[model samples]
Target: MRATRLNLMRAFAALVIVTLLAGCGFKLRGSNGSYRMPFHTIFLGVPDTSALGTELKRNLRAADDVVVLDKAEGADVQLVVISETRGRQILSLNNLGRVREYLLTYTFNFRVMDAKGAELLPATEITLKRSMEFNEQEVLAKEAEANLLYRDMQSDLVQQILRRLAAMKAPAPQASVPAK
Candidate 1:
């Protein structure tokens, strides 16, 4: 009888926990899914060979409602990558003047336009930075780690671009005036 009562109490407690979680509107990560893009077809102005460009292409392709075009012609929207740059700087130095830490930065400038060459979204810049500790003994490993971090940053930037695109509101149609 005691064991049965203990099991019943544990089950009741688990039920209460689940009910509380459900009532609080808890949602799992990525449950929101892909955001809707403003335009149906979009042209990526960046080169396909670049890392950011390639990843952006892949991500845009994942959205079911958005079509990534090869050229700017006849596209509903054109995304122009004005500039992209990557840099590293020494953050800290050791007693012997050796580098003890480094900061890696990636910056991207981009904008959106319509088929008629009117700007839809003005130029925007996104910058991401990361710091890493350096040790001469782990040169190769540190280099690999830095490369991985850069790739991760690129992925994050792609997501940011997508979210920005999703947030964009389509411009209202201009009214035409009749000539007197």
Candidate 2:
């Protein structure tokens, strides 16, 4: 009889917790449904094999209504990747002039345009930087860590691009007035 009562209490508590969470509008990340793209079809000007290009394509393809095109001919929107660059600089040095810390940076530039060559979105640059402590004894491990950080930053950049594309607003239609 006691065990049955305890189970009932536990079930009631769990139900209350779930009800509170639902009332608070709690949502898990990436569960907010597909991001709506302004254009149904988009052409990516970056090479398909590039890291950023591949990530962007994969993300765009995930959206239910988006279609990524290879050629620009029939696409409604074109995304031109202007530049992608990565750099590393020493952030700190030991007394013996050995590097103790480094800053890694990745910068990507891109623009969006319409089929008629009109700029839909101006050229913009996104930069991501990370700092890490360096040890001479862990050179190989540090190199691997840097590569992992870059890959993580690339994924973040892709998500940012997708959010920007989803948030973009189409120009309002204008009403023409007859000339007097």
Candidate 3:
């Protein structure tokens, strides 16, 4: 009988602990206040219909937890990133007028929002830069390499989003006020 009573007491304590945790803002998602909703429907907004968009969609699909939606009306969440490609000067030519090195940079302005219109995560901007030695004879090969670099950059961007989302905290329940 005493053993049964002790087991019951332990169960009761566990229930209480769970209730308290629920009252607080603790969730399974991450440390930050982010909801772990099964956000299957996602709306992606990009500046233009480019390879980046295609690659981003493919990576998100591979995640299996997210579904890229065709429209924004009923999306569980939204991901918007304005990407701009720019030519960067990494190295200069010598006195003989021979090119040295160059870099290509792509900057993305990104954000993710929940369905309730709350800013789950504010817009965070990040840039991906790739540098390569200048070779006038192999410009085509370099351009091909640039595409591969962009693909890697897309993967990195996805990882950044996942990290930020994972670190979000869930909203805490409000305490009821007694009548005055």
- Pairs clashing in candidate 1? none
**Model 2, span 23-85: residue lDDT tens:** 999989667746878788889999867988998898899897889998997788888989999
Positional deviation of 93 in candidate 2, in angstroms?
A: 1.0
Better of 1 and 3 by lDDT: 1
Which portions of model 3 show Cα errors greater than 4 Å?
Answer: 1-38, 169-180
Clashes of 3: 8
Candidate 2 Cα lDDT to native: 0.87
Measured by TM-score, how close is model 1 to the native structure? 0.82
- The backbone clash count of each candidate, in order, is 0, 0, 8
Best by TM-score: 1
Candidates ranked, most accurate by TM-score first: 1, 2, 3
lDDT of 3 by residue, 1-180 (tens): 999999999999999999999999787754452334345667878634766677667766766466788887677677766454645665668567977777767677777776656666687877877786777789899778877776787767666666665456542333456999
Return the TM-score for each candidate structure.
Answer: 0.82, 0.81, 0.62
What TM-score, to 2 decimals, does candidate 3 have? 0.62
